[model samples]
Target chain A: MSKNLVGNHIRKLRFNHNEMTQQQLADKVGVTRQTIVALEKGNYSPSLELAFRIAHAFHLPLEEVFFYGDDPTQ
Target chain B: MTYQEKKSIVSLISAILIFGFYCLYMYPQYPGGGLESPEAFRFWGSFVLILTVVSIVAHIVISIIFNIVFRMTTREKEPNFADELDKLIDLKAFRNSFFVFVVGFLLAMGSLIIYQPLHVMFMILIISGFISDVTGSATKLYHYRRGV
Candidate 1:
């Protein structure tokens, strides 16, 4: 199994999508901008529901956004 | 920082200050035994009064700062275990603090047997609890800062 649970180049994607800001995406996803920043920075992993919202916002598949691995906190 | 992070930092700092005052000033001035010497009575009475006043003032200051910055209350509610990550963090911190508390409790028990003084044992227990909580949060803060 893969150990690299790290995922996403959300900042890159945002830039590709016309300089879309973190606040804009967070508003669409019903979370605060700090949460979006945390997600983008890989400091936080979103809930499945939040993951779906993020993927939906980007018009992409969930696989393109996040990946699973052993609990990092463990 | 998230609300939890802000609240944790505030509580840790407040505890450090409280403990700092106790160790630096109160302990040295405290009388040797639990007897009612004039110095002991004066210091103990003032300590009680200062503790009450400091606690009330600290709560007000921390409450206002936390509310403004993090939208938290004085007696903050237990965090809603909203996600797996949060639960994991909580568990790690809780376990660490519990271990610390147990060690402190054992030491206090041993000292109680030797000194035969309930007051000394109680002080040890109280200090132990505070130290445990502060260290637990400090660990969590380290993880949070390291982008866990």
Candidate 2:
């Protein structure tokens, strides 16, 4: 299987946003705090909808929040 | 832990308790020696009683503990995909259990053809199937939570 690297800086974004917590981001994005933690740790890749929500939560464009990161799709 | 993880733990504990009770107590001590005993009603009553008590107690304790610890936050509502994944895991786990049941049933039938006492086989098949499903689902939930 191709190990397409998917990465995000959700933690950094949260920090930039007044040290926003995973719970806060999850509340804003309508996802679980655990999901935010997973995304920040690169342990989970969000769906398109979730991606958009996260980007919106951070007040950033989708590309700015989530990067494919040498993904095979790219 | 996620809701899925908590649910998995509860299920696994319940299964273990049921399997243990069946294998250790009911399987050997019950009337009719698992199948052919003339006191089938008595055996069934005991089995049902034990199962109900254990399940109820375990469920209550698990619910209480889950609520106190991980279920504290109302912000993390269960997601749709997470619920779907749980159901999918449950179905897959049940399929695994069914496979065990089928194998046990076949074995029992073979023994019957040889005039062997196959009474215990019926109980064994069903209980084994349940055990298989419970363990499989618990493992899957653990791996999923671990992000494997």
Candidate 3:
């Protein structure tokens, strides 16, 4: 099966936001740290609501936080 | 690990151990015995009662102990909420477990057609239900560890 290719800048955003920890971001977004870790690892694709929530946690536009592409390696 | 993941692990272990013990206890008594037999009926009746009590007690104790240990080690209070991702993982795990139950049900039906033993059918149903629950809990734990 083809792997899903949703991508995110969460790790970078966290770094930029004064070295925010995964747990901190999770608390901000009302999710478990594991969910944030999964998103960072690209092992799961979030629902639209979660996607918006993550973006809101970082105070960024949705596109700036997440995007769809074929090359997740990038 | 999350609280739900820890709970699932405990539940899966408990189910396997309890069911294994039940099978061992019943095996010697099951040969040539039908459900209508007073001895078999009484054994099953008491077994069900004991299993119910044991399962409830074990779950409560394990949950409390794990919660205490987790809080002590992590200094983070246990999260009581199931977030959107956790709910989605639960749904996915349930979908995977539903197929296991369907297969078990089909096998039980086939056994009913072939053997036609009421006691055997009942045992199959009970075991199948437990297997489904174990599968669901295991799948949830796996997803929690491996990501979902």
Candidate 4:
């Protein structure tokens, strides 16, 4: 079975959005700061609703926030 | 650390301490040289009852102290809800611990086939349950530290 990888531009987005802290972003998306830290570190994959909420927090489209593919760093 | 992580650490430590005490003190008191004993029922029944009460009170006090210390040190509010990641970690931990419990249970039953002692089986069952809980909490803390 092939593994599915989900990646995000959370760190970049946070920087672009006036250098928002992980806690701030987490607060915006109604999640714990540890979740945001995990997302930024690529240690976790967010749910679809959470993905959308995170994107909405930064006023970005879903694709701009997260991607699913082999190359997580891209 | 998250509240769940902190709670897991507390549980793991307390489980180890309690069970270790049980093994060192209570386990040796059985009439038989080994774990099997007919008279063990009364001792185990009261032992378990007292342990349960102590564990509950200890956990409550520890949690309260931990929360107060964490708030004072970090100056941060506790997250009111278990988020998706927290739930996911919990599910994974529980799944792993369930296997440990089932396997331990089967082994305990297998022991009964050989010894045929009901009280021994009951004691093993209780120990297995405690092992499952400790394993679950340890796994949750591991995931929190190492990533899920």
Candidate 5:
């Protein structure tokens, strides 16, 4: 399938937050590690609720956490 | 691979194996009566019923075994609950699977309209059921690997 348009800085943000692991972030956001992995890999666009939760996990605004573009996540 | 991916693969393989072995075991039991005979009808009825029960039991046993192996190899416990992603993928899988079965049901009815033997219709229905099961598993695997 084509890559998802929605992208996020979850991997980088997780690291910035004391090098948090995928499982830890998933726990904080109430999702499975696979969902976190999918979001970081740009394979999925989380629902608004899940997106907000992830943003809250990083203490960042939604725009700062997620962006919609062809730009790849670093 | 992640646990979800691995689980999807195991499900696909197990579905194939279970259906294959069950068909093999049942093939020799086809009734000797004429295609439209009462015995033939009874055979098909029991066949479908037994197959459903067997598939359910086998899948549960295989899932338990797979969990044991996964834990031993990866040292990670299986997630006990389905999350949003899992639910989404499952819904898509079910949609595809149901679509396939509906098509098969139509074909089976068409066979009767065409004056094909009753046994032919039965076979079509049974094969369609098997294909739908496989389709569901394959769809889950595809979405898990390639994205929603």
Candidate 6:
């Protein structure tokens, strides 16, 4: 499968935040757990509004939750 | 598999079964006159119309049953609403399904241009509709398993 450029730290961040479950984060962001699963697996890129919602769920800035390349900026 | 994947598979199977059983049930009722007979046309018309209604109602019933069964078996409630990912996947599935039906429609029309019998056109159209339904479900299954 081709790689998706839009990478996210949702999985790690979810763990950092009291080991939040996929369902919990999904509820926080107003999405299904399947969407969170897809994001963690790099199988989907969220729309801007959804991305913002996810970021907000993590209490992080957009860039802190998501990155545009294979590697995150230091 | 996730609920979406299971639902997609159930849908695909249901589409095939519904079309197959409907065809089997209706096959013997075809008019015995010439294919071009008005009675033949009437049979074909009612076949398509009744099939449409039957399939729609059957699908709705099957979906409800599937959801109930899924919740009972998995002990998890199905998602209450569609989210962005669900909508996106649905759009993609619809696009593919619509494309298939359009192609099939054109081919069916082209068959008439080639001097094929009217019954041939009717069969083609009916088959196309069934295939399109299957395609939509299959597309959803593929994307759900492989991710969109």
lDDT, ranked from best to worst:
6, 5, 4, 3, 1, 2
Q: Cα deviation of B84 in candidate 6 (Å)?
A: 1.0
lDDT of 4 by residue, A2-72 (tens): 22378888898899889999989888889999898778777787889999999899898998888887555
Provide the lowest-lDDT 10-residue window in model 2 chain A: A1-10
Candidate 5's residue-wise lDDT over B43-135, tens digit each? Answer: 999999999999999999989999999999999888888888999999999999999999999999999999999989999999999999999
Total residue pair clashes for candidate 5: 0
Fraction of native Cα contacts kept in each candidate? 0.27, 0.18, 0.50, 0.50, 0.68, 0.59
Could you give the DockQ of candidate 2? 0.26
- Cα lDDT of model 6 by residue, B1-148, tens digit: 7889899999999999999999999999998968799999999999999999999999999999999999999998899999988999999999999999999899999999999999999999999988999999998988877778
Q: Show model 6 residue runs off by greater than 4 Å.
A: none
**Candidate 5 C-alpha lDDT tens digits along A31-62:** 88888888888888899999999989898999
Q: What are the per-residue Cα lDDT tens digits for candidate 1 across B36-84?
A: 4566656656865776577568868976766765534434333333344
Model 2: clashing residue pairs? B32-B37
TM-score of chain B of 2: 0.61
**Winner on lDDT (2 vs 3):** 3
Candidate 1 C-alpha lDDT tens digits along A48-72:
7888888888898977666566433
- The TM-score that candidate 2 achieves is 0.67
Among these predicted structures, which one has the highest DockQ?
5
lDDT of 2 by residue, A1-74 (tens): 22225678788888999999887887787766656766776766677788887888888898887778753334
The CA root-mean-square deviation of candidate 5, after full C-alpha superposition on the true structure, stands at 1.5
lDDT at residue B53 of model 6 (Cα atoms):
97
What are the models' TM-scores?
0.64, 0.67, 0.82, 0.84, 0.96, 0.96
Query: Which scores higher on lDDT, 1 or 2?
Result: 1
Q: Candidate 6: give its CA RMSD in angstroms.
A: 1.3
For model 3, fnat equals 0.50
Ranking by TM-score: 5, 6, 4, 3, 2, 1
Q: List the residue pairs that clash in candidate 4.
A: none
